[model samples]
Structures are given as structure tokens and as C-alpha cells.
Target chain A: MPFSLLNLKALMPEIFLVIVASVMVLLDRAVREKAFFFWMALVGTVVAWLLARESLDLHFGASYLSDHYGFFFKTIFLLVLFLTILISPGYAKREGFHFGEYYGLLFFAVCGMMLMASGTDLLVIYLGLELMSLSIYVLVAMAAGDPRSIEGSLKYFLLGSLASAFLVMGLAVLYGKTGKIVLSELAGWLTSDKAVLTGILFFIVAFGFKVAMVPFHMWAPDAYEGAPTPVTAFMSVAAKAAGFAALGRIFLLAFYPAYAYWVKLLIPFAVLTMFVGNILAVVQTNIKRMLAYSSVAHAGYILLGIVSGTKEGLSASMLYLLIYAFMNIGAFATVVLMQREGRVGESIFDYQGLAKLYPVPAFLMLLFMFSLTGIPPTAGFIGKFYLFRSVVHAGYPIIAILAVLASVIAAYPYLRIVMLMYMREPEREIKLAPSPYIWLALGLSALGVITIGIYPGSLLTSVLASVF
Target chain B: MEKVLFGYLALAILLSALFAIFSRNVVRSVLWLLVLFLHQSVLFLTLQAEFLAAIQIIVYAGAVLVLFLFVVYLINLREEIRLPKFLGSYPLAFIAVLSMLILAVAGLVGFVPAKTVGSLSPGAILKVGHTQILGEHLFREHILAFEIAGVLLLVAVLGAVVLVRRLREGEL
Candidate 1:
């Protein structure tokens, strides 16, 4: 185990993030201008993005890998971090919980996500997951005066700790059964033993909790609705993507021989997740809760790609997550825009007659809603198209059909938002908490959605190329 | 003799764990947890993981248990103990626990681990010293994760400060 300089260089992006976060913390005490911290975090993310691009394909010991797959996921995480920061300033100013630590915590979260993406060992991945979850728990509780925020953070923390416990227990069992914790080494112990099966089941439950599959998703909506709008957006995309990245790496690589067994185990959960998320979303009055459920449904759709267990299927999941970051965050950003003083803009009723008053923002919201529902010429549709195609290619047309039906059910809630905006008359005076940063985030998201939707070939090609 | 000692430690660990969970008094639960951690550490020692055994006692039994006792002291323990424990979901919880217990027993009955020993065998640990072996592995083999763990601790500290600090006027 020679400590090579190249291994250190491979970790440059994550190290850079840690440095920036520490600098932000120190600067926060001295600088009165909050925008300074924001600018610093923004610059830090851009630099880390560049570092990640430059350091791709480098390996750090046997425990950490910075291959194409990890690099691509890191790119997604940095994108999510960028969009989250862009959307945060406005909401933080409006809500009065904008601390320097918010930005720092976000950087730390992306750092953790990068670790999860690159970690080659189970222990490293688990630590990375914990880092991400702890930052998010604090972010969720940042608005300490809000009871909902406190409750949400408490629930997320307790349940998340339990999930981590399950993960540790799983790893212990796995280590005992196979005498291995590294993903590359675990493949050798693929015998159909009951102890190994139990270990794999624990891994499934742990990762299932991370990705919010079906029964494990109860914490999502409450946590989402209670957190700050930008934080919620970040959680829906970035956290879930990190989970899927680690889940894909561990299950597809480590458990390759038992692929059929786990895929069979996951299929029912995936179907249940889709139906539960979509059907429950239709009844939600709170906008955040609805999107939370929608995200859960999206998780099921993404899980379809993984359960397919083909290169094409995994790549489609990556593309789906990449596109989901845009459309989902865009939808949440619109909710942020609707945050006028004295009204949190959490209710679907808040959007009634929005198109009549603010046509531009309303149109943006409509585009996002359409994309979320998997309509054509939006990134969400392209994402779903490839996912279902991959599933079909993998000879699971039944699951694909079921997913499409679930998406149809998902459409009702997504489109209902659009319908409320365009058709209903104004019941009250609509006031928007307009900010330049939110507009930038929304515009970038819209641009991504439309560009990738129409001509997804380039992104698709890279996604396929990077399916390590 | 070694087998007998291992058996005693295992039974003690299980009994302490059960008592930790089912104890009505919060303070009593914390004490039971201490016993559980101590027994578990001895069990680790029997497995030839002396470093892990020491850590189990130092971290979990020492620091973590003390923290638990502090928390219990700060809270109104009488009210907490008076609350109905199961909240009417006893049957469902019982079924789930029973099934899981059965599954674990079934799995463990005929389980023989695959023979894939790593470099850190008992002989290797004895030659190099357990702590030295662990230090070399942590610092050289897994340095990236080690540094990341440091960052994780920093984030935890920062989170605690952010959550507890009072806000000033016009400060984000």
C-alpha cells in the first residue's frame, strides 16, 4: 500500500471542497456580507467541478476509485450543488435562516456525495452516506423556530441513524460471510448460502432506505415539507442520486453473481414504490409533500433501470438521474418563487391563476410540470424514454408497462399544478418573492430540460460511455 | 476454556442488550447498555481483535454511555417511563421481531464462512502488534477515507454550532 501522489491528486476535488468549507466557516465570523460566503461557495463548486474533470480515471488506494463512473456522478452532484446554491439565497433571505454554515454544509454534502460515488469499499461508502445525511439533517432543522422544521429534522435523524445501523449490521454480516468488504473482492464470494443471502438482504434494506423505496419512504415527505425550499430541492435530487450511485456500484458490481436473485427481490418493491408515490401524491395539498411523493415515484422509475441489470439499463438510470436533477429542481425553484411574505407558498392553491398574473414564471412552472410528467420535448420524458427502453431491452416489458402506467398516475398530480395555474381565476392577490438568483436557476434548468429533451444524443452517448 | 469464556461473554451481551431495551427506567437502561458494550468488547477480544475490543470499551462503553447517562439525567425520566411503551402496535412489532429472529437463526445454523482471510491474521497481528497493524492500514491503505472521516467530524461540529447559535439582527 504505497501512498502514491496520484492517489492524493485523485482526491483533489473532495479535498478542495473540505478546504473551501473550512474557509467559509472562518470567514463567516468576520464578514458581515452574506453574499460573500455565497460567492465563495459558488466559486468553490466551479473549481471542484474542474478538478473532478481533470482528475477523472485516477484511483486512490484500493478503497477509493475515481473512474469514469464516479467522475460522471460527481459531475451530477456538483451540478445539483450549484443549482441548490443558486436557488437558496432568495429563500434564505425570505425565510431569515440564511447562515454561512448553510453554504458550507452544502459543500460538505457534495464532498460526501463525491466520496460515495468514488468509494470502493463498504465502510467508506457508509461513512460518506453518514456525512451527507448529517449535513442534511442540520440543514432541515436550520429554521429552528419552525416546529415543522424541528420535527422533520428529528424524524430524519432518528430514522436515518437506524438506517445507518442496518447498513453497519449488513456490512458486518457480509464481512463475516465472505471475509471481504471491498466491492471488487466481494464478487468472489457468490455462493448461494443462506448467510450470504441474509447479508445481501440487509444491504438491500439499507440501500433501499437511502433511495426511499416504498416502505422506506415515510420520512421523505415530512422532511421535504419541513426543510427550506432549496434544501428540499437538493435532497430530492442530490441525496437520492448519491444513494443510487452507491447502490448501483455495490449491487451491480459486488453482487454480480446473485444479480437475478436481488433483481427479483427488488422488482416488487419498485412496483410498489411507483404506485404508492404517485397515488399518494394526487391527494397532497402541500406542494412540497406532493413533489416529495413525486420524487419517490421517480426513484421507483430509476430503480427500474437498475433492476434491469444491464449496461444500457444502468446508463439509463444515470441519464434519468441527471435529467431528474434539472426538472425536479426547476419545479421546486418555482415553488421558491411563489414564496411571498406571510405565505410560504406551500399550498397548491397558491398557484391558482398564477399564469394570469406572472405569465413568465407560470410558463416556466408549466414546462417543469410537463417535464416531470414525462411529456415530450422535456428532459423528464427523454429520461423516462431511455429507462423504459432499457428495461424492455433487458426483457422486462411487464415492468416497463407497469412503470408507464405508474407514470400515467403520476401525471395527474404534476398536471394538476399546471391546470391550477392556467385555468383558475385569481382568488387572492398573488405576490412573488422575486430574486435574480432564482430566475437564473430556473432558466438554466429550463434550458437543460429543453436542450437535452430535443437532442439527447450527446448526453446519452457520454452516459453510455461512462457506464463503468 | 476459551470456548467457555466466549460462551459466557455472548450470553452476557445478549442479556444486557435485552435489559437495555426493556428496562422501564431510563437510567437503568443506560447502565444495561454499559454492560452490553463491555461484554461485546470482551467478545471482540476473544475473536483476536484487541484493537477493536479496546475501541468498543473506550468509545461505546466509556464516552457514549456517559453521554447517554447525561441525557437521561437532563430529561424528565419519570414522565418518560410512565408513557405506554408499545403504543398498541405490540402484536405487529412482535410478529416482525419473531420472523426476523427465526430468519437469523435459520441462516446461522449451517453457516460456514468462505475461507478468504486477509493480511491481518492472528499471527500477523502478533508479529506487528495489533495497534500498529491497524494504524498502518488506516493511514496507508485507507488514507482517503480517513481524511474524509476527519471532514465528517468537522461537519458535525459545524452543524452543532449552526443549530445552537443565536441569530443577530439583519444577519443571515
Candidate 2:
């Protein structure tokens, strides 16, 4: 085939992201200050975002798409990536992990998420998943000599590769039934034939693993607790978003005709994920592990949107994801900034009297925690409201009520952090001197949560417009 | 003649796969895997899938087996090899395997794959040469996937480098 501009136009954003990642790696050296990569990555991601915006309607044949759906997802990824890079430099410097590889691998992960969101074919999706997973595995282990880092990456990698195996096996089964690898083709195959139960089961298990749902969530707390803070923040938002993107496309788009079977399959898993994630989060002393379980619970809430299997449901998941990127990243930014002077302030006690020490960051952390707990006047509230409202509207009111119950239980831990930050006294004088970039990351995330919370109408309109 | 050869190949593959799973020694298990891969290639050849047969031999038997061997050599497996832990409780394992086989076959019994053949027929592919025809599809219709594959490889390369590269000058 000729190299048509039309065909390649849709891939411009992904191509640009990868190019930027490569350029960053090459430019990782020559600059003495490793933080320079952060600035460069930020600039490059913004440019890629602009490029993505331009191709919002260009669906490139069967293998890729650049529609508003993908464009919205790519925008979410870039948002997460931007904030991650903004906070990474300071965190890396503090943790003795100031390496060039960290910034480059982060961009590599961003590139992979972009591809996964844009991909219309299973092969492309699978490749993108691995690319992201590979980069993340390395990024998790970046603190080379740290025993926790090594242990975490090992557990994450082994389980991650097994999930990859399951995913490929699932794809093989689907292909065997239809002899096609494109997502669009499967729609026709399933609509005409019996739904392949084994194939769909594998997909659920694989995606379940990636999104850290229960029974497949054994790796998450350890990996999150042990990974460098910024890395954890990046994966919690972006990696999970990519997994949900794949799940939305594969199930909602391709296997949509067999929704009955899959929705029945998902409802129980959703309830279990919600209960396990929320209940487990409350008992955690380590803030990182608590957030990891919180992420799992958040994932369960998002799965509520998926379970409804309506267009509104899919967009609700996307909106929740958008709000989640800002709120969760903002929460982690505070933790990342607190890792100053070689003291990893990961324990819940570390936050005692944070308001007295650093009023601005403490306030920002409180705002994010509120958003996470789905309190009113926060984006998290709007996100969860829309998710459960849509699920209820879709005739799953019981699940929605159960979800609300889970959220109430989830509120206790988040509020506990607030109590520590505001009411309790510090054991020792905790030092927190966040860099300018950390401030910027925290400020932007805080602003995002507030702006979206006050007026979700505009963003919700756009999100609804993007759904197929 | 082809039928008889296919039967022989299938039997060899089955036997080698079982032995590979049950083998006491890792090295011997790898050898069994090689036999299985070789038989698979032969079976592919019998099915008129020449390109797949070649890939089965080249990529699986040649490249992947070598990588497996390298891994075996890289780690200390002597203790593991001497452990004699070849999945104990033979009766239960045998029953489990038999049941899985039965269920799998049962599930697949009436399932017929819809014909979604690529641009070239097997006969035409034979005439055009395996590599060339395969290259055409890979580069033409699936070119986007091809580029993505290139990106995957690049990520893998960077990952390997990041894992091994020492950031600071060390006393070691």
C-alpha cells in the first residue's frame, strides 16, 4: 500500500508520543540535571496532546481509530502523564532514584497507553498493553538497590506476564472462532454465532488482572507499597485507565451482542471487588497500600459503569476516570512531596499535623481525599454520582445501592487521613520541601477537582458526545 | 502416505509434550520441547501451511529453544533438577488432565471457524513464495500493526537497558 497521508494522519499523535519518548532517552544524557527530562517530557506531552486534539475524528481504517472516543482517552493519558512528569523530578531526586531511565520509561508508558486507546485491533491492543506493562515493570524497579522495589517489580512482572499469557490465549480463541483479529469483526461474529464463553472468560480474567479486581489483586498492594511514589501514582491512574479502555472497547464494542452473558458475569465480580477493595483499605496503616486498595475500589466503581453496559455507562466510566486522574494524582502528589530528606513518609502517622507543617499541601491533600471519598463539592462525588446514577438508570438499582454502601465504608479511611493531618499532633518534626514542579502538579490537580466538581455539565456533555 | 506421516507426527508431538511436562531434568525437558516443536512444524507442513511450518521450526525450535537453554544455563538449576518433583500424585494429575482434555474437545466439537482468508490463497502463496506473500500482507493491510510491533521491540530494548544500566559510578 502507498503511504497515504490520510492513513497515517490518525497515527500522528501516537507517532509523536513515541518519537518524544525516544528523543527524551537520547536527551537523557548531555543534560546534567536529570530534572531537565521532566521539563522536556512535559513539553513533548503537551505537543502530543495538541496533535491528538487535531485528529479527534480520523478513524484510520480497521487497525486504529482517532475518533472522539479515543481522543478523549488519549487526553486523559496525557493529563496523567503531564502531572506524573511534573512530580517525578522532585520525588526521584529525594528517593535516590534520580535516573534518566525513569523519565523515558514513563513516556514509553504514556505512548503505550495512547496506542492502546487508539487501537481498533486486538493485536494492536495486546502490543500496546505489553509495551506499557514492560515499561512499568522497569520503572517500578528503578530504585535499583532497594529491596522493596526489587521485590515488588518481581511479583508484578511474574503475575503481569501470566496475565499477558491469558490475554493472548483469549485472543487466540476469538481468532480461532472467527479468523479475524480486528475488534469490529468480532461484533459480527458474536452477533451471528454463539458467544465463546471460554474466550470471554479469559478476557475477563486478563482484564481483571490488569485492573486489579479481587481474586486477581494479590500483586497490587505489594507493588504499590514498594514502587517509588510517582511510579505508583502514574500506574494507579494511567495503567488502570488503559485497562478499562481495552475492556470498554472489547466488551462494549465487540462482544456487545452477547451483553447478557458478560453483564451477568460482571455484576458479581463488581460487588466482590467493591466489598474487598473498600474493606481492605480501611485497615491499612501504610498510606500507599491504603491508596492501592482505594484504587481497586475506584476500579470497582468504574466497573459498575461497565456492568450497566449502556452508552451512558461507558461515558460515565470515562468521566470517572478523568476525575480520578486528577484527584488520585493530586493525593499521591502530596505523598510524593513528603518523601523528603530520605524519610519515605508512607505511614499514616507521617501525616500527623501536616496542616501545621505545610498548610497548602495539607489542604490540597484534604481536597483530594474528599474527592476520593465521593463527598459533595468534589469531582469524585460527581464521578461516582454519575456512575451509580447511570447504573441505577440502567435498571441495576440494587448494585448501585450496594456501591453507595461501599463508598460510605470507603469514606472512613480517607477521613481518617484528614483527622491525622488536621487534629493530631506530630511525633517528630517532619520535613517537607516540595519542588516548584510538585507545587504545580498539586495546584493543577486541586484546580481540576474543584473546577470539574462545581460545573461537571460541560465536561459531561463532551464526555457524552464522545461515546459511540 | 501423508496421512500416515501426519499420524506419526501427531503421536510424536503428544508423547514429547507429556514427557516435557513430566521430565525430571530441565535440560531433558527442553530437549523434549524441541522434539514437540519439530513435530508441530512437520504437522504444519502436512497441513499445507508452509509459512507457519517454517516459522515453527525457525522461531520456536531455533530461536526460542536457544533462549530457553540460555535461561537454564544462566540460573543455578542443579538443585532444582535433583529435587525429583515431577508433579506428584500421578492418579489425580492423570484424571485432571484427562478431564480437561475431554471438556476442551467437547467444547470445540461443533464450533466451525468462519472463513476469513487473507489476500492470497495457499496455492497462490506457494507459487509466490512464503516470505514474499507473508511480507506483502504484513506490510500492506497490517502495516499499522507492523509499525506497532517495531515500537514494542523498541520498548523491550529500552526496558532491558534500563534494567541493566548502572546510573552512578560504583565501587564495584
Candidate 3:
């Protein structure tokens, strides 16, 4: 309970974001220029990013820790927020739903993501998770004219509340079994007790639902497709990364003693997730839903790192998550760009012969598609390589092979888009939504993907160093 | 006296919960839910948790139930009542519920409550008072979480305004 200066400093960025977001909420009502909120959020994110620093000290009774691990995820969250805001104004304005609450909610969501990454206690992490989920539910329902948006939001809210209930139950059981909630302290109370296993299983289910692992991923496609493109992009990467952040920390720290048990339990789920996501993605006509499935598959890949139960594996997942934020958001940014007056650009066939006219977006989409397929010379390849190598190193060569097969199946849907863009003629005349900011966001993502794709050693080493 | 009150509260809770779920009239169902909430609060009171009892009444019975009533009022109650009371797949739902009940009972039957030593034990709660002890923890140890909850409420309000407001072009 002692609030030290250092602890206050550790929480500076989160506090700053909360303040800025609250002020923006006020400003949004008074200001006429919707673009003003965008600038505020953008500047706020930059400031928050600069304020973030790695502090190994655990603040507030081991509830929060500002460490390099959290710092890495925070950077990703900020990057996502920046990119999402960049791509949002045009879509929001075009769709006639431009509001300051949109940007404010995003800031709050990022603050939640930051807390999730940094929190070392179950209570804190749960609070963070709820904060993030609530913001996202509202964001998804922002398009008032679209019934699909409301449906998706409601679905997400219901399923998410169930998951939260499960998590609370798990936390209660764990607390009863151990009288502890802090990650480091919980390790000391490890037992082969049935209650502990039950609690752990509940936790796994909740995390699985959060990260969109198969069987628990029923809401992802519906929610992703129905949501605004920018929100979809934000949720797919930032929210999933937050889930994995907490998952990795809890498993590696609190449940490390029972790694063999949980790893075995998780492997099948991961394998199922990869196959379900990839195979289902192939049949999707909507680009957003396809990317939703693709994101689910990517979650399966990230789980390989945790399933390996190695520092290398954990860092590998972190690296993959960073790469994913870029390529996935980049893809969604393109979808946001494809939104014309009448066409929302939800269908994959809409991209046909796009290379003939809007060659730049077509090529950018091509780059993203290739990257998603884990093609070399892109960040996705580097990410997949590390994840596979780490899993193989952990002696799960079979899971690694299955992951590769899943990746192969994944190649078909992603490459099909590439082929469609270049080969088929446009079924109709395509006019893109005008957004200068989207280009900036897309360019940043492409740069991140290609730069890290080619020169991955530096990013990899930093990620390796950051792992807790 | 405590045992008698506890027995009555528990029975009332179960009966009201059943009534809430089975009532054909949606408003009547919500009213039954209010009864369930009231019984739950009395149960908490019997347990000597005055703060929880108060919160159960204020938050659940007072606030949440009222909100539920408002929502039910907004919708066409006659049409809702006319709609099928249950989905066609009730047998499947029954099976799922039965299995879950069995599993939960099985889990609980085998479980022995571990003696969790903490600063605020039952004896301490009686000495320090329930609300004060809770406030201390809320404002002291878990202050960050408390603050986060505040922000969450703010976002929830924002969400309500954003979703329900009329789309005004430029001048609102």
C-alpha cells in the first residue's frame, strides 16, 4: 500500500493516459472538429510512449510491475492505438459516426492493455481486462446505423462476461488454494492439488477465449466482421497481445511448476486452433472475417511459444505478437481504405483487378497477404521461424510440424487474395475512401513488417532481452 | 434466530430464482428477480456481512433491477410474452445444466476449505467493522484497481452516450 516515488513513476504512463482520455472526453463535446480528438489521442499516445520506461520494481504489493516485458507490450499497444486512430477518422467521418468518444475509448483501451501487460496480480489483471473489454464492446457498437455492429457488440459482451465469470471463479479457487494472487508469490504455493488444477483449467479457458483459440473463437469472426475496420484491426492485434501478455506471465511464473500438465493440455488446443482458423479462413468471402480467422491462426502460433514453456518460446511469442500488430493492422488499414461511398469493401472479390487501377493499395495488400502467409522477406516469416524453432527446441517437433501444416493451409487464403488482386479484372469500378492518414499508418506498418523481416536480429535480440 | 432467518432466506432465494426464470410475463419475471435479490441480501445479512447486504440491496436490487425494468419497459412486453418461453433445444440445455450441476457438486463435495490466514479474519472483521475493513483495503492496498474501476465506469457512461445519442452533423 506504500506509494513510493518510484512506484508513482512506474505508473506515470497509465495515469497520463487516463487524464488525457478524460480531458479528451470533455473536449470532444465542445469541439466541432472531429479531427481535433484524433490529434489529441495521437499526441497523447506519443507522450505516453515516451513516458514508458522499464522498472523492475514491483509496485503496489506485487500488483503491478513496470518491467521490460511489459514495456515491450506497451510499445506494441501504443503503436496499435496510434495506427488505429490514424485509420479511424476517415472511416468514422465517411460512415457518419465521427465522435470524440471513439478516440477517448481507444486511449482507455490502450491504458487497459498497458495495465494487463504490467499487472502481476490476478485482481489487477482482471480489472485491466474488463476495462479493455468494455471499451472495445462500445467501440464495436459505434456504427449506430449498422445492425450487424450492434449484434457483434452484444455477442462479444455476452461471451466476454461469461469468460470474466470463469476467470473470477478461477481466481477465487486459486486464492482459496494458495491465499495468494501475485504471480511470483503464487509459485511458492504450488501443489498437485485437484482444486489448483481446476482453477488453472478455468484460467486456461478464459485466456483461450480471450486470445480466440479454436472452440472458444466463435465470436471472433462475427465480431471482427461486424465491427468497424479500424476497431477490428485494433481488437485483433492489441487485445490478443494483451491476453497473451497476461497468459505468458501467469503460466511461466505462477504455473511453471505444473508446466508439463498445462503444456499437454494446451498443445491440442493450439493445434486445433491453427487448423480451425486456417481451414475456416479459406472459405470466408468477407476480407474482415478472413483476417479474423487469420488472426486466430496467428494466436495458435503464438501459443506455441507458451506451450514450449521456455524463455525463448515466451520471447518468440512476444516477437510474433509485435510483427502481427504490424501486418494484421496493415491489412485492416487497407480494408478501411477500400471503403467507398456505397461499398464497405467487406468482400474479398472486391479486390479483383485492384492492381489495374489502385496499384499502390493492391501492392500493399499483396505485401500484407504474403507477410500473413509467412513468406520470407516479411516480418511474419521471421516470427513463424522463431516460434517453430523454439517449439522444436522444446522437443515438441510434432506440434511444430502441425503448426507448419497449418501455416501451409493458411497460405492458400492469403495467397488467393494476392492472386485475385493481380489476376482477375475488377467486377465493378472501385473508388477508395479518401484518407491521407491511412497511408501513413499503412506505410508505417509495411516499413515495420519489411524492416524487421529483413533485419530481424536486432528486434529479436531486444525481444529476447525483454522476456521475464 | 440466525439459523431460522438463514433457512427462510435461502428457501426464498431458490423459489424466487425459479419463478424469475419460469414466469411467462417478462415484467413478472423481473419482479421475481427483485424478490431473488432481496432474499440474497437477507442471506448476506444473516452471514453478518452488513456491507455486502447493503450493496446487494443498493446495487443489485435497487440499481440493476431497476435498469432491467427500464429495458423491459422499452421493449414490447406483450410480444415478448407471446414469444416461445424456451428454445426447442431445451433437452440439450437441461442435459448441460444437469452435468454442470453434477460437476460443481462433485467438486465442492470433495473440497475442504483451507484456513486462509489474513489480516482481516472473521474476528477482526467483527472488531474493525466490515465496511471500514473493506474501505481500508479498497483505498489502500488495491487503490490502483479502485481507480481503474472508476475509469471503467466513465467509459461505460461514455459508451451509453455514444450509442444512444442522435447523430448530429457539426453542431450538437
List the RMSD of every prediction in angstroms. 2.3, 3.5, 2.6
Q: Candidates' DockQ values?
A: 0.54, 0.43, 0.48
Off by over 4 Å in 2: A1-6, A192-195, A341-343, B1-26, B74-77, B81-109, B118-133, B167-172
TM-score of each: 0.95, 0.91, 0.94
Candidate 3, which segments miss by more than 4 Å at Cα? A1-6, A54-58, B1-12, B79-105, B166-172
Candidate 1 per-residue lDDT over residues A234-329, each given as its tens digit: 988999999999999998999989987888888999999999999999999999999999999999999988899999999999999999999999
Between 2 and 3, whose lDDT is larger?
3
True contacts kept of each: 0.63, 0.51, 0.50
* Best of the candidates, TM-score: 1
Model 3 chain A lowest lDDT segment of ten: A53-62
lDDT of 3 by residue, A1-468 (tens): 344443577788999988998898778768988778888889999999988863344464557888899999999999999999899988888667777777888989999999999998888999999999999998898776677788889888888998998899889988887778788989988786777877887898899889999878988988997788889999999999999999999999999998878887799999999999999999999998899999899999999999999999999999999999999999999999987654457788888899998999999999998899999999889999999999999998989999999999999999999999999988876878857899999999999999999999988999999998
Error of 2 at A238 (Å): 0.4
Per-residue CA lDDT of model 2 for A233-322, tens digit only, reads 999999999999989988999989889888987888899999999999999999999999999998999999889999999999999999
